[model samples]
Target chain A: MVVNGAAIEFKKVRKTYGNFVALESFSMNVAAGEFMTLLGPSGSGKTTALNSLAGFTDITSGDILIDGVSIARVPTEKRNIGMVFQNYSLFPHRNVLGNVAFPLEMRGVGRAEIRKRSLKALEIVRLGGLAERMPHELSGGQKQRVAFARAIVFEPRVLLMDEPLGALDLKLREAMQLEIKQYQQQIGCTVIYVTHDQGEALTLSDRLAVMDKGLIRQLGTPQDLYDRPNSRFVAEFIGLNNIIKISGSKHDGAIVDGLGVIRFPSEIQPSQGYLSVRPEHIRRTPTGGHPAIVRQAVFLGDAVRYVVETRNGAELTLAEPRSGENSSLDPGSEIAISFEENRLIHLPE
Target chain B: MKNRPTTLLLLLPAALLVGLLFVLPILGVLSLSVYGDSGFTLGPIRELVGSRVSLVVLERTFWQALTVSVICVVLGYPAAFFMSGLSTKLRAYLVYLILLPFWISILVRTYTWIIILGREGIINRTLAAFGFSPVQILYTDLAVRIAMVQILLPIVVLTCLASMLDIDKGLVKTARSLGATPTQAFVKVFLPLSLSGAATGGIICFILCLGFYVTPALLGGRRSILISNLIDIQVHQSLNWGFAAALATALLIITLACLALFRLLTRGRTEFSSLGVGR
Candidate 1:
């Protein structure tokens, strides 16, 4: 079943358990065929949001619309959404073929059709020959593929994955992340994935929703989130950085602050906002910017990261290429460090 | 091989106990059935096949045991399923109620059935108070069947329950999510999964029923006499030890056969993990 261009809309959805609000008036729009990951830590309501879409959970209030149709009362079976769990909840009693065929069997598909469809699904996962084997006989990666195959066997409108690759090792997780993303793109199914890992979200999702404390903190493309981070949380979370909270003002087209006045962009509005600078963005300058004492310089294979304590006592991290590095300043040596103004994101008030 | 001594030490006591209490008696009975009185004789073996009285008792005993086992399974399956549906705390208490009779002596349990089914018992008295005639209950074949089923019901229910509880709850939820109705999910998943346990329990009940003596003797009349009763009659009243041993041997052989058949029927099911024990 093809999902038309209708977006998934959550209209003032709220979920509560007694006095604890799991999701407070959560609302978002997921465009058709878009891959979005709800990235958050535990108990951040990312999983709750995914569960609400899968119909495994009922919201305490409000309606969820899929393809412009209200599905608040629709049961999970009729929701036409595939779900892959974190632990890969495959039926232990059934073989791989039987597990993949479960969806077809539930829909009362005929015997020949069930076999044909299950084989096709297993073939897609490259597990066609292993269809006779039970789940316990397979490795973590193989079991996860079987889970994906099962989720996609019936061609649902959307796919919901609750950290499907969370159980795999680093190498396998990376491979499966690419594989799952390929399947989603190939089938053009809307994917609502939930994971706390920023790397996974950045690698797989077309658009990412950074969630914290039961709310969507930011929803944008990975480049938008990484390049133009709108909050200290998004900046510090999406990448490694030195976040300096300093009072500053716009004067003569430059941001004048506690460290020193540096040339910022002309159109940049200087206000009481946190400035986030990436470690790689900072460069060693000659006698111009903030004067800093080099505290530590650790070589990390391809690059060297420096920890500097500015004259104002604020610490800044700078990364440079390991080869032909100009800075020979030791721990006690003092130098000047400057950063680009465009990389600094203004935090919300 | 290094830990053989420790293993042997741990198993030696059990081995000796079974050897003395179980294997030794079976060997003795087999020898007595073959070697018989005066000398090794085939008279008892011949008599076991030729005697009309032995044949009739054997037939009645087999049918009664089979009937009682079937009744136990038919009633126990739904009871156990109902129990599994209850909350954990309530199920524990209900299980205790089923097992209360297990703690009592078999003789006491058998006699309690007698009182309940007696003409002057509460049931018949209630019927009489309603101006109805008292139904004959005690010392009948039906009385024997009821007593056997009651005594063996707990084993069936507990066995079935163990199997049912072993099923993963997620499978049911997954089934429901895959568009299966509640009845379909249970029939296709839970029922098949629990059948192995029910079969094991039923076999055990049948085997135990085949060897019943005290309950049937206390509750049933002449028509309800089973193979064990015939063995008892030959050994005590008829003074025929060889014939009695043969009858015992037949019962033992039939029980083993039933167990083997049960195992064969359920071999392909992964849930029947303990079928090796039946062999």
Candidate 2:
């Protein structure tokens, strides 16, 4: 539809239901046409933020500006936004074409124009052939497609999705994810997506905010969060990683982490915190590092993951690619591992 | 479900009860109209068609039943809508409140209406105290209609409330997000979805009104008498059991027709009106 999306700004918004604070100083600025996902576990402030923007939930304080206009007093209908609910929520009384045409009809569009736009929107979702079918006749995936068509039929400037693919099966969910990205790109509408799935957030978002307990834990691109997570929670949430607590750090490269004093990489140092390293970064060496024993070996098709325990009783995982001429390790096999010191990130407790 | 013998066994008690209490009597009544001691004849049907009083009373009864059903829908739909918005606990309590009248005997409820609308009753007595003279509402068409409505309102309300509760609230929220005003959402989405329930309830109310005898017998004036009252007179005063059986057969046939229509209206609507079990 080539919509010129609006820039959205949430200025220190807060929402509370009696004693439960849903959002506290939740602020974000989304550029037009950007896909920003709010990623979190359930009960985080992400959904509250989206609901407030759509006027579904009132912000206790602070203001929300779309493009530059304050919409605090604006009703949900007047907000001029479209939302795709988690459940399809297609009107059972209407056919697919009718469902897609509803928004335009509400705006009092001409019949011919409404039909033209609705068909075009349905075509975008690959559901043009099922226009005459009732909602229950369509399968779950088709219903989701029709819901998408209905949301974007009017070509709203901004769209909100609340775990829209939560109901789909694994294969269908993966397929729909790619389709949703393509649709968003074609429409060029700013999408504020909410999901608890980290993989979905990584695949679709231009930027994402990870929230926990009514606050944003971290906000950045997928690469930034994956490569250098700023907290232990984010490190664990974003990807599989090994975190070793740094009990002490010396003026040189020597760091004590309860195991023994190991000479860490000096160039990126000068702190006492946890050592965050990805499994792929720690590799088995021919000799002299830390001696460990493999506890479990799991076959992951592309790589073999081994759970290894150090001499000090710390369990750490490491993965080795199957592409190379590498032999799989058995449980109780003795091995020595070394970290890629330069890739290790320091996180404050 | 496919076990035929078990299915018949499960239905045995109900089948026996209906056969003894309902079917045999209905067959006898219907036979009385067509088969007399002399020979099988259409004499009772002919007399029913020729009698002007019987025809007028039948037409009046039909109109009164239709009016009562329509009034029940109009009054009950809004009350149901209000109930559906309440909290779960509060809604449960209010449903009991509305059903309170259903616990009382229909005869008692009809008589209670007399106390409210009769001369020297509460309404007329209050009017007199306010310096207006007593009005003749005691044994009028209005009094009968009021009593019938009060007696049947509970069924309509429960049916409407049931369908309203089935509706997914997400549809309304989705409508609002798609730029529909609240009133437009309710009119275009909620109203159409809920109409099936109201239609079924109206048909149920209409069927009940068709055979209504007690309220009209007690509250209606001579001019406002319905088909049931006429049938009563034919059996008791005129001692014409054949004509009364014919009138009753007509009422039973019409009620059956309405029940068929109600089934037709409620069955196919599930295809569209029932929002599919959400994804």
All candidates' chain B TM-scores are 0.91, 0.92
Fnat: each model in turn? 0.24, 0.54
lDDT tens readout by residue for model 2, B138-221? 788889899989989999999999999999988988899999999989987999989988988998899889888988999999
lDDT of 1: 0.82
In candidate 2, residue A61 scores what lDDT?
97
- Restricting to chain A, the TM-score for each candidate equals 0.92, 0.96
Clash total of candidate 2: 0
Q: Which stretches of candidate 1 lie over 4 Å from their true place?
A: A1-6, A246-273, A286-288, A291-300, A306-317, A324-336, B1-4, B82-87, B270-279
Compute the DockQ of candidate 2.
0.47
Highest DockQ scorer: 2
lDDT of 1 by residue, A1-349 (tens): 2333336888888888888888888889999998988998888899899888878789999899998999999987788778888888777767788878878887878878788888888888889889778789999999999988888888877888998999899999999988988877777888899998999999999899998877888999998998888888888889787776546664543343446555445465555666677898898898687889999988787888889988878888899877775544578888898887666556643
Tens digits of per-residue lDDT for model 1, B26-61: 999987888955778887789889988888887888
Clashing pairs in 1: none
Candidate 2 C-alpha lDDT tens digits along A13-83 = 98999999999888899999999999999999888999999888888999999999999999999999989
After superposition, the stretches of candidate 2 with alpha carbons farther than 4 Å from their true spots are A253-258, A262-272, A324-327, B259-279
iRMSD computed for candidate 1: 7.2
